[model samples]
Target: MKTMKTLLSASLALTALSGCQPETEKPNILFLLVDDMQSDAIAALGNKNVYTPNIDGLIAEGVTFTRTYTNGALCGALSMPSRAMLMTGRGVFEVQSDGMKIPECMVTLPEQLRANGYQTFATGKWHSDHASFNRSFAAGENIFFGGMHPYEKNGHCSPRLYHYDRTGQYKETSFIGEEFSSKMFADAAIEFLSTAAKAQNPFMAFVSFTSPHDPRNQLPDYGKKYKAKDIILPTNFLPQHPFDNGELAIRDEQILPPPRTGEQLQEELALYYGMVSEVDEQIGRVLNALNATGEREHTVIVFASDNGLAMGQNGLLGKQSLYEHSVGVPMLIIDPRSKKHGFKTDALCYLYDLYPTLCDIVGIEIPASVTGVSLKPLLEGTTDKLRDDIFLAYSNQQRALVKDDYKYIIYNVEGKITEQLFNLKKDPKEMANLADAMPQKAAAYKEMLIQRLKEQQDFCNIDTPLWWKDGHKITWDELINLYIFE
Candidate 1:
């Protein structure tokens, strides 16, 4: 396979030493992406409650990026901008949010792969605008144009699934019936792999699954797999957020009535974990399909989520918050030919970095407009880290800067200003806010955040001192009342 020089050298050494023969052609890429999955939710990574044999298998067979974060969302529905950044390899401040429309000027990951003679195919959710989706994939099936829908329904429910012909036309299809989203997407991918067995050119299958997002529902047996009472609550779980972080009235936060109890949240967590396990079973089906086609050893499999979710952490039920449960996601890249298995790196990276990193892995030139850096060094065992600091922003209301072992967060909604700082090394859950205790360090991080925002051209009108001077008083009762509808 055509890969980075370092990877090529390492592969050659392994092949020579292990007496394994090298292929002369390019390898296939199976891009498996999920929606609204938390980083710590995977069974292999640390969570004991979730049963994810297939995902854990991938972790055992690949290199995992332990510390991967999304740049941030452009709206309350974090999936929109997060998918935009992922597809285009652009920063949060640079992409369009609605439908995650990729600009005409930019080249997407699939588009570049297609240009290089790879048969680019996609299935499942396509949250990006139709124009970009059409431009990226040569063929698509069982495509859900919208972001999310009710995962569980008692009656007959069939969300509209469309088929995108390579000729820029979409055809309505009933190919996807009442099957669960994960199973339906996996079925289509397995079928595609079976069909692709005869193709001469290499393929890039972009299998995107919308599971474990919301309407936390799995099959009856899968849902019953996890017990609500057995699921443990997050360490930072609370009945309500301490203050109004500006998204108190969002639809995700309104999933359940106020005064969320531990038992009820645990039940939701049980369903969420069930859905994760259900998706893992479907992933096993797709991997079996690849192996059945004899392409398992020649294919590169990547597993990641669009963004993360805050299922009960920090008293939030959605991804609108800046907490680790909301921003961090699990990422694994598996190269079947590589000898490195079960290797994990704690290198700081953004989700968009996958674009350039995959391009480098496959020896394809990265697009000019792509701003993400390639993690080829880390993959090739040449480096341990890619980035030291990460910048975050969401809808011009929240801003965060993570450097060293400390994370600084600033929230300005209306005329109120709130700052939070946490030593992530000590308190990864962000339970302690050191803003008032360490004022000088907080100010330094605030300045660093502002400077980083400037570098990203994110001029969101963050009037810090103005709000600091005006001193808008916000009480816990007032913040709680915001979520109470009239």
Candidate 2:
């Protein structure tokens, strides 16, 4: 029998003889996740208004996915399911959004990496349950275990931080308002990378930032950098949403009431962009830390968001809708070993695909439960497209299918149904509804949507026309009243 070391040498020799690339050292992974960040918000991605020098620096060294989206959202709290899908490499419809828990049986990305001799660390917004966080990461710090924080009138508050002790018990530490959430999390991540520099095993660090989400309270310095009047409103912005989409009563929609003025939207945009810029600075700090530790070229960086936000798009102020602004998010990946930097692909992909893609990059076997396809081939320039089209769903209210340059959207709920179709290349804002002129295309897309639903085991009854029930067509007010708001 061959000795273990002799067998490894022989395997590598055989691989070299076959003209295959030899295995290299596994790279460290730094995954940066932001909340409610729209695809167009990044300055590097052509959003002329936002300032994101740090994120843009990564873009210069990475490949940007120009058309990535969240697979689905069961409710208005979209981040829960979005993060769940990201953690477990599962589809939105297949996970439990409530309690934000990942099944115990499932292997999370961090968990798998830890099992493969990588030290896993996490910090920042953990909207998912504590059990999943504790299970996935070997260590954590400055973690927020719940959803959005309460509004601070003076923009000051004492937030608590939590971390896992050696005994595995989570301990809480009181925090002062001096440091903002972004800085706190980034500081923790920088410290983690510094410590990881001394460790033999490579580290996998998840730095999740909760910013550009809500309360629009930008840091004073960052806020002063932008003027509201100079901010441009989205071209698709509407004073009010035309009809009820089953989520009209959600808290997110109430950010501004009907007849939203351009001034208010611009003001809000300034503050939101300010927060994004601040987050970009924090990212820069972390990157500088990576470089300081002499790990810059040996680490892989992934920057993405849990989901995108509307921010006054299509007469909406939230992510409950299926528009590009609401569902499409920025995904940037930088691998130092690859020569294909500053590349981009328009291929359709869900955020969950990152799990398998990272696994493929690190030479780990993807988990059996993972439904997302690896983008290694696409990233390596061996393929142009990983998928041809995409499907999006939000609650039982909205459905959309995107193929080529055409997007078909359906709003079905209660006793009303509406259809919309737009040639995205011609009308990226979805300003033109071609369902009437293109009935055949709409019918074909409806069939295609049904087929995708069946494949995903979504059993929503969408066959029947929802225009009339009990001898009356549903009114917008009635639909709004049906929602139970907190």
Candidate 3:
């Protein structure tokens, strides 16, 4: 029953009486990634104690952008270079090794939309590698491959998963999923949107959901009506991390233990907003299985999150600090042929610019070893500024820059250097540290964060004295064997 091929009601009434416009057909993309979701954890992006009615109904019907970021903190784990800069749109030192293996000369946005005929699929948390999730899906299933697991509260955790492997050599990946994990990734994306609504090409379905990051409990009682003394702390909550932001003991800032309080960061924000309202009720049952597989108006949905989680904010709880609650995330796109209904774009983008903005929304081409930069003219609004300055690195200690309205951090643990600027529109919770009262605007944002760390080819040496002694040094047994996945 694979359908979709219409237009003949007298050529749609002669293209609606010759007004033209009907050429669209290629829009099926449901990305919806999530993990550590933080851009003000929605309640229509203001965080009214987080209940996220399906991520506040995709921020009131998508187009949200709100300054999305992430291109920082590697090996200290920024989920394998933020899912390898979102499947190789490249950046954060050009996603090769920090993405934890994805260098067959990049091309991934689901292997270029599964070599352009679409149908690409992949389920839940694949922190890059497994031969780039076996050159990005062409059929996938309940998979999951690290960055967190051990959730067990009533959903009786089993974890350990994987299914699609056409010999990208995933080799007998122990399938186990007994619910939990946003209900086994919304039941493997509602069994791949009911066999991708009868399949006849057009499909992308990345899915991926690790859930509110951190096994923040709540498996079934769906957070017993959110109670941690009615959680509410973060006015830039702090009890530590005043300095030594040299990852003050990693593994996500030792998940609690610093002087941190206010009733222990309100019971870890009531188990991180009750695992973000049970991953927003399993993303409202995977958007009601894409509207019971009618393909939710030809898909093109993109909601994001690969980084952003510092549940305890400034006193950090990880996402290795570039703060705005660990690298401002949560983005959306929802193109049903945009006219920007719920639009919001503060546009200093980069989530590896959503793989050349989903290859400029399906017309495809985009790949010269991709380096991001395509929000598709801010999603057809034709322009809203893409960048003037935006850089952040989190390895050889730290470095940051966000030009207009200031925010210039810099630190270097070993050699003991430190500095911070922050005027993020009059201190957006950076709690005043105008770097010696704005030393020439913090040395012109440390020379635009050293020209944005040589235009994001970062290894971050910031004129080192010791800056992690020429970078990439790692060993706590190689950061626990680069986040165990075997």
Tens digits of per-residue lDDT, candidate 3, 1-486, equal 111112112212221343323323778888878888788877887777878887788778878888788877556768778888778787677665567777667778878776666666677788767877867775666778767776452222667777665566877746677677677777767776776566556777787888888767554565335778877787887888787776778766777878777898888888888787887888888889899878788888888888888877777777787877788888888888776768887868878888888788778788888877888887788665677878877766777888777888887776778898988787777888889976998987797678767665564558667655444445544433332222
Tens-digit per-residue lDDT, 1-486, candidate 1:
222233223322332343323322778999999988999999899997888888999999999998899998756767877887888888887775432567678788998887776777788888777788878876656677777864453211355566554455555343444566777678778877876655666788999988877766435244227889999898888887889998888888888754688998998898888788878888889999999999898899999998888888888888888888888989999987778899998888998999999898888799998999898788778675578799988765788998989999998877678999999999999999999999999999988887887788774545455433243433333332222111
**TM-scores of all predicted structures:** 0.88, 0.88, 0.35
The global C-alpha lDDT for each of the candidates, from Candidate 1 onward, is 0.78, 0.78, 0.74
Global fold similarity of model 2 (TM-score): 0.88
Candidate 2 clash pair list: none
RMSD of candidates 1 onward, in order: 9.1, 8.7, 20.1
lDDT of 2 at 270: 85
- Candidate 2 regions off by >4 Å? 1-24, 152-157, 165-177, 218-224, 465-486
Model 1 has an lDDT value of 0.78
lDDT (Cα, tens digit) per residue for candidate 2, span 1-486: 323233223322332343323223789999999989999898888898988989888888998988898887766678887888888888866666432667676788998887776777888888776677766877766777766655763331334556443344455453443477788788778877877766666778999988877767646353226799999888898887888877777898887776789999998888889888888888999999999999888899999998888888888888988888888989989988898888988888999899999999998889887888898887788756677789888766678899989989888766678998989888978888899999999999988988887777663545766522442333434433332212
Clashes within 3 Å, all models in order: 0, 0, 0
